[model samples]
Target: MKKKGIFVISLDLELIWGVFDKVDYKEKSSYFKNTREVIPEILDLFSEYNIECTWATVGMLFNSTWEEWKSNFPENFPEYQNEGLSAYAYGESIMSPETEFYCFAKEIIEKINATPSQEIGTHTYSHYYCLEPGQDLQSFEVDLKKSIEMARAMNIELKSLVFPRNQFNSEYLKVCKKLGIENVRSNPTDWFWQDTQKDSLKDKIFRTGDAYLGPINKSYSISSLKAEKDKPLAQKASRLLRPYSNNKILNKLKIDRIKSEMTYAARNEEIYHLWWHPHNFGSNPQENLKDLQVLLEHYKRCHKEFGFQSLNMDGVNKQFQNILRN
Candidate 1:
């Protein structure tokens, strides 16, 4: 009998400007640009494993940056016009267009499109915060529609989505379905600010918490200044202890989490959705990648023992839909 396992790797592809609007891009472009090198390495690794992964890219990244690269640097950066740039430059206002930033992002988007065996998904038009209660549903819908349209403009077909900030609004699911999206990567109950409806059996859910599987603990908080100050000690300890914390630990803990939520999936199995920004790997990417590699290897081992198989978000949702039909 084959062991049951599911592996879902979701990427939130956005520029540092989109994430950190406060930073001065003109002076700090290199700092923001440095973080992006890890992305190609990640793509390479996924390619090596023949991994079918989901890239929840910000549509503006493609339209703005990629388009610019094509028009501005056609000869030297032919790939940039279609592929996507490593970084982008944007202003303070969220909705405002920053042409320079778009130029960079467009190249990056094109590059991602060129990669084979990868699925491009939606992250939202401007990386909106859906969790903010004041954000009206209409506005959310409009932005969601815009994101889908932007992808269409790029001639890219979007099949999956991962909410920005893990802010899964139930209403957004309807928007996704209407847009022909087949699946979404959502947070599990154990993560912070999870939705009450997420516990229901009807929705397709994925568990996500970086610390839970890696050197850190899910419960650890970094919000407080005090916590940040004290984290170095814990970080050092985690580095020393990580080698000993093997697949056995991951299997035991992750399986228990899945079993607890098995009923929510109606025993059909829920996607163990693991996701994070590619930039997150930048701080100590090699170490982070090593940890991820260990987890992936463990997932492969588990696939042989359990019945679960690794899937991109679309593949997982298709399987779930098939199960529902029966």
Candidate 2:
């Protein structure tokens, strides 16, 4: 039973907290509103397919109002060398009724909590950047503690974490383990996926091309994870489910590449983990949902033919633990 193929899906639910450093709120306000509107629909699709997903939400998003958000800030804030990278600084003048949809999402979090087989994981208290400069282990721990505290306030115990921006730092796993995180979404082993914070134009080009051309075998055998004794198992990501594209031919190729990879994992009895941000669907929710439905349908076929199973990060971690115990 353990040899069967495993399928894992994770979502980084950051609202604007994830992109505040990069995008302007006023210009992308409608985009954020669309994202809030589409989350329920996405959850409904997951239910229809009996899919289990891990939503690694930013802790700041749990607040219903601006005042609540301000009160929940960590005692010790991360002091990044570049001040623009600080969410706390950005939040100073950003909260209002106009930006309410982008800043707070407590109601959306409740909807996800109500969904069956869905795991609510933390994306850190402030979407903290682990690999960024001027941030230390002590500060990271403070952020994680704040995240756990906020989730607990909502009756949620976060067992899984997905670092913001795929900044996969092995050093931080110890902090996560100490704070009760069972697993974390690590970056893929391929060179193109490594050191994402310092990503180069060449690497970016290759990553995008790999999505359509199949430059590498993204899936891996579960036995590999068994070899590691790390407490917070590093559940490596296989691919990012790139958002809807207007170019029809390119979109088809991207979908084909994903199908081919899933087929490989299913046939070889390996693990295939796919992830993306919920806001990636904001611009074109219908098209994104259509593509997602196609992928889920492929997953059903793979499950029927090869015993492929859909599990969240928590489920995958539990399965790995069982193997170790046996």
Candidate 3:
């Protein structure tokens, strides 16, 4: 049973907190709004296809109002060299948590809570950047504590964490382990895909090309995770489910690459972990959903042929733990 192919999907469910340092809120309002709108449909697709996913949401998103957010803010914050990178001084002016403000997502969270086949995981209390220079482990612990508190307030148990921007610090896993995080989504093994604070231009080009070509395939075998004993279950991500594009030929090729990888993993009884943010589908939800359907249909065929099974990060780790215990 453990040798069967495993399919895992994890979503970095940060609407704007994940991109505040990069994108302007006003310009991307529609993009965020569309993201909020399509989450239900995504959940529906998952339910329809028997797929389970872990949504590593920013803990700040649990606030119903700006005042609630301020009240629940973590005591210590990540001390980034750039002040703008820290989200502590926000919410004093231009506050709007009612209609999908930049960071708040109480309503969206409620939707997720009501959905089935989902695991609620933390993306840190403030989208904490682990690999950043100014952040300390103690501060991260504070953030994770706040995350646990916020999720507890919502009657949610967070057992998995996907680091913000894939900035994984090996030392931080102890903090997560102490806080009961059973697993974390690590980046692929290759240097090009290593977790870094600053992605170089060459890295970006390689990643972009890898989406359409098999430059560095991210898929891995289930045995790959069994090797990590001390750290949180390192469920490495196979590939990022990039957003749909207008270019027909390029899109087809990208989907083809993903399908090929998925087929390979299924046939080999390995694990294919695909992840993305809900906002990636914000611009063209329909088109993105269409492509997602193609992947799901492929997964269905793989399941029928090779005993592939869909599991969230938590489920995968649980299965591995059971296997180890036996």
The candidate scoring highest on TM-score is 2
Indicate which candidate wins on lDDT: 2
lDDT of 2 by residue, 63-158 (tens): 888778888878899999988989899888686766767888989999999999999999998899888899999999999999899899889999
Against the reference, the lDDT scores of all candidates come to 0.53, 0.90, 0.85
lDDT for each residue of candidate 1 in 229-287, tens digit (9 for 90 to 100) = 11111100011112113456763565444333322222233334456677566455676
Q: If ranked by lDDT, best first, what sequence of candidates would result?
A: 2, 3, 1
How much does candidate 3 score in TM-score?
0.95
lDDT of 1: 0.53
TM-score of each: 0.64, 0.97, 0.95
Ordered list by TM-score, greatest first: 2, 3, 1
What count of clashes does model 2 give?
0
Candidate 3, 126-231: lDDT as tens digits = 8888888788999999999999998998899899999999998888897898898999999877677874678898888888887887653557876666545456
Q: Evaluate model 2: give its TM-score.
A: 0.97
- Candidate 2 wrongly placed segments (more than 4 Å): 226-230
Better of 1 and 2 by TM-score: 2
